[model samples]
Target: MDLDQLRTFDRIVREQSFTKAAAYLNITQATASMRIRALEQLLGVTLFQRGRTVTLTDQGMTFLPFARRIIGTVQEGREALRRVERGRIAIASLRSLVSPLITEPLLRFQQHYPGVDVVVNEGRQAQIVAMLHERDVEMGILCWPNIDPLLVDLVPLVIMRERVPLVVAPEIAARLPARPSIEEVLALVPRVISLRWWQAEPETAAALVRLAKTSVELPTGPARRLAIKGEGLGFFVNSAVADDIEAGRLVEIAPPDFEALHRDTAMVVRSLAALDRDMLADFIAEIARECAKVGIILDNRLASLGDKVA
Candidate 1:
């Protein structure tokens, strides 16, 4: 009936665990159960069927969207008031990619709307998802494949794709042949600089894992630094090291039959309703405009979302 009750219901469904939902809400499990019970009683319908694993009943499925809308409506009202009183907006993205990707867009947004305060947060995919679901951030810019619909209804806007080149230190490249096989590349790069969490997709992550004998996994910033210092052979997104490769600091070590490695990025919102606001719409536009400067255009994948587009 109330916002708190609706939030508990929503989080329970998303997390699929009463214990996790309770912990996330900073409430006791018993209290969470009681709230759900009270809500079901008020509605005269059993929301979730009790079982070893909680599954939403027919009633719950029908009510889910309405509950989400209610919570989103409340959050939107708060955001509007915050704009007037605090002049603030929150955005999140990867720390390393933000500079090459969104820095120009954000700068232009600031120039045109200097009065609006923009708070930026940087983290891995899981962290970003948490922030989005909690309404801690109004927008997120990250790899498109990393967005999971169950966590949040993302309004994905693919801005660019970069080839994932296999590279080594310039000195190492000189000693190696013009092209190497997968096995040779793996053997040469004993300590491959792999990203532990921020992969383009699950299949890509699995492929990389199988290729590396001894991997040195790190987050975006540290991974780039280690790769640059020639600790070992590395595979990286082209944008992350395009300058280094151009300057001859890094060399591409391609396999004879290596497929081009392309990763796509998108601008996302928690829900389509989240994008209905003018501020968010403008921000999305700014991202597209800035990406155009770098020759990245809005992708058809985003265009296919139909009415989800703002």
Candidate 2:
């Protein structure tokens, strides 16, 4: 019924344990229990099933999203007030994109606006989206195809397309032809280290699964490392493996039959009117500039903004 009750319920759902949630919230276990009991009594439904591990009941599952929205709304209001009091920017980004996409722009932004506080939270796609919706972050940078502006309520400010090339250790590359067929590459090195960096073309994703003798999904960092260690061939963004390729640590394989692979990463904001317009525009320009330095192409829509802020 109250904010404390809603927060307690949300924390319990996330922690999946009353004791753990209570500890996190810095409240006694009895107080946490009492809050939940009061909430359930007011709602007239059993929210959680009593057990060693907390499990949400049907009613609890139904109410969870609403409860989270309420909590997020309150938090958002607090963040808005804080922003007004001082210059602060919070961003959520995909883990894989942090080094390749965010780092340079962030460093540049800081140099220019030393007084403004910037925070970057890295997570998977869903987690980043959640952070944006919850107003835990003002912006999000992530790969595209799953984002729907209408559905997620996040507006795309800029989108960058980067080429993803199949790379392998130099030793493995030495055994293959200049323009080998995918089957030939597979024959030479049966293992494929897959990183779902983007929503790859369905046919390409399926074909890799069908043809590779051994396929293992890994995060971008580990997959790139494994490819460098000669464990398997990996498809990595050009920026991610550029240094390695230049140093002869890895070789890019261009298969005649394989479609060119690329990933689209976008910078999105929940509401532009709610943000510091000049600051946001300046940061977007910095991102575009960094992308260009590494051969990532920005969307046509951002060209005008780039020019204005460049």
lDDT of each: 0.73, 0.79
TM-scores of the models, in the given order? 0.74, 0.81
Please write out the lDDT profile of model 2 over residues 9-101, one tens digit for every residue.
Answer: 988987899999999889999999999999999999999998988999999999998998898889988987987898887888878667877
lDDT of 1 by residue, 1-310 (tens): 8988999999899788899999999999999999999999999999998777888999999999899888877877887788779667798886656777578877887887788888889887777776776677887877766646646457676556656777788776776677767776666565777664344344644575667777777766677777777776556777777888899888887777556566666677766666565666666676666555544565744455454443
Candidate 2 residue runs with Cα over 4 Å from true position: 7-37, 47-66, 147-151, 199-201, 295-310
Candidate 1: which pairs clash?
A: 164-261
Count of backbone collisions within predicted model 1:
1
- The TM-score measured for candidate 2 stands at 0.81
